[model samples]
Target: MAPPGCPAVAPVGKWKVIGHLQLLCLLALAQPGGPAWPCPALCQCFGNMTVFCSEEGLRNIPEEIPPSTTQLFFVETALASVPSRAFTNIAGSSHLTTLAFLGSSLEALGEAAFAGLPALRVLEISTSQLTALPGEALHGLTNLSTLSVKFSPIETLETGLFNSTPRLETLHLQGNEMESLPSDIFHPLRSLKTLTLSQNHLAELPGEVLAPLGSLQVLKLSDNNLTCLPPGFFLPLVQLQELFLDGNALMELPPGAFSRLTSLKGLHLQHNALRGLLPSVFAAQTNLTSLYLDNNRLTELPERLFHGTPSLSVLSVANNQLQALPARLFRKSPCLTLIVLSHNRLSRLPAGVFQGLPALTKLLLSHNNLTALPRDAFANLTSLEVLDLAHNQLATLPEGIFDSNIILFNVALKSNPWACDCHLAHMADWLQHTDALLNLQTLCRSPAYLKGLSLPTVKKEQLVCLPGPGSSRCRAEGLEPSGEPGTLPQCTYQDPVGAIHLACDPDACQQLSLHLPGQHFSENWTLGSGCGTVRVHITVHIEQDKAQPGGEAVLP
Candidate 1:
């Protein structure tokens, strides 16, 4: 999530993202006739009571921060430490609502460093060398609301650190080295809403640590070593909506573990060591919508696991060791849209397994051991769009298997050992007419004569039934299209490092437009009428729903 006043855009690389915000500031101290707001030496002051200071050499805070200043950002500076009464110069300045220190080497913070700022609300000390924050450091900010000390080396948080800030709402302490926390440390934050404690070494949390934040909504504890959750650990977060407990070492969840999170919506338990889950574990998450149980050691899921979550939308159990799934597993989650069951050990799917998911659009069954699917398995998915059945052991699809998916546009049948015989004539004829797109490399892997032929480019006459009695089978294969205009469209994908390598045909068009399938809007760029590749980092956003993890996709 972005800082208090920042727009909702993800940071790139890490702490350096904050430096990008500096580019929006007027480089000059004060625009020629912008505003009279005092521009402290070594700082750029804007008309909107904001000051940005980013320069090396001088140590300590700038001599002065205009008393009328509302937001102050310090990035890539050599200034270090905030001695006692460090902000005494701006004491009692209620208009100063935000103070952030990014990419700095400030290691020490005096006990009374922020002594008397009455109305200060947001304080972010990110990506610094600070090892600890004194208990009384935030002594007099009575109305403070957001406190972010993230991406620092802070090892521990003092017990009474928040004794003075009663109105605090958001606390982000992720990316630290803290192993444990004081039980009553959060006993005073009655209005706290979002707390992110991810990327830490915490193996366990005190039962009462989060008992005070009844108003808390989002709690992210991902990338930790939490092996288990003590009973009642989440009983206090009655209003919590989203919980991220992924990337942990949890092995099992007792029945009724989350029976009290009635208002919960998103539950992420991916990348853990869970061996199994009880059907009642999520019995009370009636409002749940997203559940990520992928990348685990599970072998099976309870048949009625989701019997209570009727509003469930996104469910991912990919990358597991399952051999089979109970056919009625999703009988209650009628709102499901995205289901990722790839990278599993399953060899078969029970008929009617996906019968009632009218809202499902994307189904990933790739990298599995399945050889065939029940003919009507997808008969009820009227709204299905993207289906990935690649890298499986299937040789042929049942006739009319995909006839019900009228709006489906993308199907992945690559890496499968297709027979390219009578049964495959349906898929070949469908590919020749329908608008559905498949991988260009989808090949036939049977009948020695046409072993490596691309399925999409095969002639319908060559898909006749195998030789019988005196009949003979032969190959009249068609060549794969040259992917030029009027042929196959270019496809682009995002690499693991988040760079889009776009290939444009300078001679074909003057502008390049990218429209990600399923996205309400598109990203367009002009290639400047030149040639060569341009690599740039990207921050993904979706017009609807939470931005899902990045992956490969074909662009038209």
Candidate 2:
């Protein structure tokens, strides 16, 4: 028991002893060297080690951190700039592996700002207003492996900006305003494997700028303003596997431009101003698997353009001005699976144009000036599935154009000047019979007639027919149907079928012909006879097959 003025001390049990020990431990932790600090309302503590001051209205980094704190995250704050000596005090702590300022209002980074991070492996400061990067900003990040500064306003990067980070494996500077890179900007990154600089304004690249990246596997420079490429521009990237140059202003590629890139598997050069391709432009790249050359100004291709690339699976040359193609253009590429030649000026196709490609699956030849097609045009294309011949001048097609291709699915022949003649009789039959094939709104535009009429709806009787005996003819007296005269009696027929069908024996027909005015034989004339009389003689011969089975049948 204690005195009257003092508080009484109760008898201690196990629980009371434990409570006193915890109080002593808390008091020890509350010292200057402990984890306790003047944390803000949005901060939390984890036993003497780390502080998470996330989502706070902090304008800058806190002045002081607990001495034992090994990691700090000031995420989504109102930080505008990381001032000098910001992380100088944290050099004494060796356990900090990450320091992220993600989703903050950080606008700029001063010189030597990040020189204190020694063990930092990743620094993600994306979605910032960083217009320019200081040369020495990321100098001390020696062990950094990944750095992503995407979606920034970085217009220019000074030389030696990445001189210190040698072990960097992945660097993403995409969605920036970098128009050009210094010649030696990437000299120190010897171990880099993946580099993405796409979605920028880089018009041209110095030859030596990309010559040092020996171990690079993927290089994406798409969506830029590159007008042309220098010779041997990409000759140094030996290990590059995928190169994307799509959506650029590349008018032409110099010969042997991609000769040194032996390991390149996929090359995208789509959407450019390439007027044509030289025969040997892609001569050296034999290992290419996919090549995209769509949306160019290629008028035609040389016979041996794809002579060496046997592994090419896809070749898209759509939206060009190609009027014709050589017979053996695709003779060497047997592995070509897809070919798109739509939106061209091909009025006719030579025979055996696609004879060599056996594995082709999809063929697009729509929107051309083709007026007719040969019978065996698609003879060798056995594996074809989708054939597009829409929007052309195909007036007629020969029979069995799609005979060899049993697996044909879609045949688009719409918007063509299909002549509704006897030549299209089989097509009309197929349109009504073939249920598996697609017969789009094909109309006719030929024979100086049958225009503005649907092919499916036109009747068979309206189609043109060859001249025969039943066709209208005109002849004169003593003249045969061929306008030849004879000594024997002869009669001419005028507007033969326009009158009516008549049947008579040769002897009986001559009697009726003598009743005309110009004949010498006279007849018992009927009443109200005309003053003038003409006589005409006719002859006829019946075929042996026209006789009845038993004997000759009498004429009516």
Candidate 3:
């Protein structure tokens, strides 16, 4: 591992983290211009501590290593074996803390190959042809803290190979062909904190394999062929905070499987065959923050699954078969920020479903079957910034649905089958009010005449009418209200069913008048969807206008 405060380099594949001091050593390998020394002819020395060699045909270990060298790396070398006492000449004086054999063809190791390097803290052998190591391969390295033997074909490990290094902490055994592990292989390293065994062929693990790693904090077991986890498999990982179980064949997680891992903060179970999750599976994980269960076969999640995990912030359950969610499912998780429920079969959202998530910033419900949203759907989401309702069956939004979202700036309402009618006047009014709204235009997909027209350019009058009666034959032609300043066209629309919807230009301020003979009725009025400047509406009943069947009830 790099020193305590080394600037971090972005990790590539399984490249070990190295400091700038070590990076200079690598740069010397390609440039061959570091300070001169009595170094091996093919090796380049950096300062007084690091030596790097990358000659392809070199057959033996360079015997002239500087005694001040504390770090050595052999890249793409032909060195085949490290005989006993191979580095004894300089080990005592060098006090090597890091050694690596990358892209090497090494196949065997002498029992005491690392004898005199007692201060070694990091050792690695990756992209090599090494097949196996004897039980005593690491015979005397007691202070080593990091070890890696990745991308090698070694199928098995001697259970006693790590007996000499009890203080080891980080172990990486990924990219191997090992189908199974010896139950006692990791029985000695009690101080291990991070273990990576991904991209291997492990189908199952021994029940007692991880019983000794009680201090492990991160366990990565992704990209394995695990079909099922043996019961009590994670009981000993009480201190584990991040666990990656994605890219496996597991179908179900037996209840209480993670009951002991109360410290878990991030759980990745995506790309699995999980059909469902039990409500109490995470009852003890109150500290959990990010949960990923996307790309699974989950048909539904238990309503109270997240009730115990109030600390959750990021949740992605997309690419599942879920059709709906409980109304108060997230009542307890008030800290959620981003929720992705896209690519599901959800047809509707329960009112107040997201009313408790006041801190939510982005919510994506794209690619679903949602037809409409309730008016107060986002009542408590005053902090919401990004909302995606694209690729659904949404015709329009309910009136004042976005009134509470004052800070919302990014919204996606495209790709929906938008019916351009009076019901959609509210959407146009919202667009007019929020002029800064991105994705300004969407295609109207209904009413053959308005089909292919963009919503932003279409006049409000062209985008109106209730479902039946004279709603479609809109006539914005009649007498203006008395004392009105402008010669505004009277926008009249009739709805026999309880309400009449209308839209007009705010500048003209249209005055609506209706003439009904021998009939009068009570009135109920609300805000109109016109320019939003004028208030209109008072129900006028019509008994039977034998001359006009479209219900022109009251006299102007």
Residue range 362-462, candidate 3, lDDT tens digits: 89999999998899888979889889888999987887788889988677888998887768878776766544345455788875446767777766645
TM-score of 2: 0.69
> Model 2: per-residue lDDT, tens digit, 1-556?
2222222222326644443224434543463445355554565545555555555477866656555665566556788998664676643334555566656688888776766667777777766778888787886788888888777788988889898889898888888899998999999988888888988999998878887789998888888999988888888788888898888999988888888888877889888888988898778667776888888888888778888676676788888899999998888787777888899899999988888777778899999898888788888787887888988888888977888887775677788878776678777766664443355467777543356667777555445433344432222124212222332222222222212111122222221211122223122221111211223333333354542322211111
Candidate with maximal lDDT: 3
lDDT agreement of model 3 with the native: 0.76
Sort all candidates by lDDT, best to worst: 3, 1, 2
Task: List ranges where model 3 is wrong by over 4 Å.
Answer: 1-36, 90-93, 432-441, 470-556
TM-score, cand. 3 = 0.78
Candidate 3 differs from the real structure by a C-alpha RMSD in angstroms, to one decimal, of 10.3
Taking every candidate in turn, the Cα RMSD to the unseen true structure, in Å, is 17.1, 20.4, 10.3
Worst 10 residues of 1 by lDDT: 472-481
**What's the distance in Å from true for residue 439, model 3?**
2.4
